[model samples]
Target: MSARLATGALVNALVRRAGSAGGFATVLAKGDATAGAVLIVAQDRGENPRLLERGIGPTGDVELIAVGPDGDAQAIADYWSRRRRNDPDLWVVELDIAQAERFAAETMLGD
Candidate 1:
């Protein structure tokens, strides 16, 4: 069987990695420790903010899929707000990285 990492560890790893890379990272919403889903919002200085959610592909591999090119703050906030209402255990992380998808690809747990 494959081992999975906990949510809290992933959150901390993300924060530390972003900081070490000279970027900013913060957890907007805390979630369940064991099985919460992670959503990442990547924003750059004058570009559209992109949102990615953790997903499992057909082959059982984890990947980041773009939710939207949401440069609008209110729109992204509103979207997550609606999502938060449904899943109180969902984690939302904001990372100020240009290539934010790499974070998910590198951080996601695997065999």
Candidate 2:
């Protein structure tokens, strides 16, 4: 099996990439640095909010899965808050960009 990137490193890289691309990215909650799971809150300039997480698809390949509410910012925030409460090891990052979902998926699954 291939090795995985540390959660902290990935988070930093993602933030840098988003900023470099003229977008906004920030960590909502910090989790374990070594092996925490990441949850991405993607939005297009603070609109069309979506929650993305890496998960195994039916074909067994890891892919970005859309979880929680869509379009509504408040519902998405509540959803992530609830999830974070349950999984304290989850890293929550918010990305507001042109193609937030694509950026999140590439940065998260590329490594």
Highest lDDT scorer: 2
Candidate 2 deviant stretches above 4 angstroms: none
Number of colliding residue pairs in each model: 0, 0
- Candidate models: Cα lDDT each: 0.80, 0.91
- List candidate 1 stretches off by more than 4 Å: 58-60, 109-111
What tens-digit string does per-residue lDDT give for candidate 1 at 57-91? 66886777778547787788888878889999999
RMSD of 2: 0.9
Pairs of residues clashing in candidate 1? none
Candidate 2 global CA lDDT score? 0.91
Residue 57 displacement in candidate 1 (angstroms): 3.0
My TM-score estimates for the predictions, one after another, are: 0.87, 0.95
Q: Put down candidate 2 lDDT per residue, 1-111, tens digits, no spaces.
A: 999989999999999999999999999999999999899999997888889988898899999898889988899889989998999999999999998878888888985
